[model samples]
Target: MKLKNQHIEEFLQSGLLDRYVIGDTSDTENTMVEDMINQHSEVQLAYDKLQEELFLYANTNAITPPDYLKEQVLNKVTPRKELEPEYSKHENWLSIAAVIVALLALSGLGYLYQQNTGLKQEIVETTTQFENLERDYELNDTQKRILEMRLAFIEAGDTEKYLMRGYIEEEPLRVIAYYNQPAGKAQIEIAALPELEKGLDYQLWADVDGEMVSLAVLNDLKPKTISAEILKKASDLNITIEKAGGSKHASVENLVSSIPLNTIP
Candidate 1:
């Protein structure tokens, strides 16, 4: 029994267990290995261990073959020769079935990969739409705040509107002013004003006690604001064209327009 046990251990380590699990053993060798598995506990355990390892390897390394390769593999598969009566038909059937199931699983993996890729694209598109909606919401919120402020200014009791026109009729310059005397605040609208030549800008002045005080230097034609205490005592508003940036003192000869605030009442 000791010698027989040694033979069995030697057989287990001879790499026959690997060949048997992958269906590479001959009919005679197959019979011998099965008899050893039924008769010896060690042989059976080694065979079972080989089967488990093979299954784990197949699961870990399986891949989806391309369509043409799938057809080629199917065409290459042929039935094995009929073994003698002593060979187990049940074992052959299990091997063939395992092959079929593995092929089907590889095809299923291809489908699952496509589904995963499509889901990733949809996630990207949904993220872009959400970002665009957030930007639009922010723009609408800004416009809402601007409209509310404009409405408040219109409703104030001390607010006055003044229109100042250019002295030279051919130049055709104009501006509108919304002035609040109590708050000493004013908003100047220059939308109708002509575009300035290059290297020139419009400068505003408040005529206080015969002196022209600098209020603001205009860059673009956008609306301007004057929020100074000096506006409360100003008798008139003036605009003049100055060099780039502006001048320290108004060029009285270049006065474009002037409106008398004291005569407005």
Candidate 2:
């Protein structure tokens, strides 16, 4: 007997692709048909691809048909005409139930399709963010290494240095220095300092001749170098402890350290 399209579809749904290809002969004629299919290269390729898709579908766990699919299939296959005429009254009711089941199956399939599409889009977006973060991390590491090299060069020479001293709430006396060079730019390195009290800050200054210029503010002086723009005209550098934001003019009594440009090599 020739195999019908419905038979092929049913076999596919039941996940018997391997059995169909191998031509198991215990049942007779199905074995012969399987042998023919195996011999055809075109058919074999199509079968292999179909098997891959079916395996993916099984693993995804995303496709779920409505519960009423079986009931709808049974209803359509039942021999209604062979039943007694008394059952005619019930035929309309069965037909309506079958239609409802089909509608529900269609809705379920549509919802599953939409969910699968959304998950794919989310995966793509997360991959893009990960790539961007990797690039930023590499750039930050390069900039940090360059800054360290520059600080080592400054610490090796007789850079002009100033000292600042201040007391906050009877805390231990704190001192910091301003190191300026004749090359127009300088860095401030804190050496031998007391811990700062809560809610107070230390600031650096560059006093050119008699005129003082503010340089930077230090909150937590951890052993790391910070970059500053080169000063255009400054002869002296000073440091002072100021109110949190610092003051417009250096309070004479607040002076912590003073270093002149002529003294620095």
Candidate 3:
């Protein structure tokens, strides 16, 4: 029911309306036109005008006769000598009308050709737009599903949250940890952490009992979410700036942030 001017114009320019009015279109086309006429006011108005014109033309009750009948009638009306001038005048005017009709036919063909090309181009453009929209919709749908999963994990009854405030940054920076004991999964969320300098690596470590265990390397921590495997005996978490790959043990002098995790579910 929602139609644009261009869409309506395509059908009108295709000469389908004339065919529908004269019962010349195929069954499918007739069905389409008839449906539009019922649903679309523009198509209905066009069909009505065409029907009016057809009716008026039929009701005129006068038409051009055959050439043989016209010749017989003209021959009876004039003398043989005077009729030459009349015939000459008739022939001249008839030739001009024929040329005009030919030109009109050629112009009509050209117009139809242009309309067909425009419609094809519009169809191609519309198809491309639809594909792009579908792709974007799929991408957004995937992101939405991921966010929903993260939400469910955070809201789970067996999840514990830990927030670590960094003292190294002038601006306030924080890291959030979500540990789910039942699922044995740990997720890290960095907030307001600036870009790391080249060659500097931020390594994460889990302090179990008194021994430090390597957990993950927090490289380029730019306020993004990351997941780490929770150590079975780890009681605390910490981050330290180390070499590019990471360090075997926690560098307490390079520590930026630390959090105790004894209350995790």
TM-score versus the correct structure, for each prediction: 0.55, 0.48, 0.51
Residue-level lDDT of model 2, residues 49-156, one tens digit each, is 854664454345333455686566566646577777644433443444344345445656767777889898999899998888888888888878977865655664
Task: Quote the lDDT for 76 in model 1.
Answer: 42
Please identify which of the two predictions, 1 or 3, would achieve the higher lDDT against the true structure: 1
lDDT of 1 at 106: 74
What range of 10 consecutive residues in model 2 has the weakest lDDT sum?
223-232
lDDT of 2 at 114: 78
TM-score of the candidate numbered 2? 0.48
Best TM-score among the predictions, by candidate number: 1
**What C-alpha lDDT values do all the predictions have?**
0.76, 0.56, 0.71
Candidate 2: give the clashing pairs. 163-256, 163-257, 164-256, 164-257, 165-256, 207-236, 208-235
Off by over 4 Å in 3: 1-115, 208-212, 219-229, 243-250, 263-265
Clashes of each: 0, 7, 0
* Model 2 deviation from the true structure expressed as Cα RMSD, one decimal place: 12.1
Off by over 4 Å in 1: 1-115, 167-171, 263-265
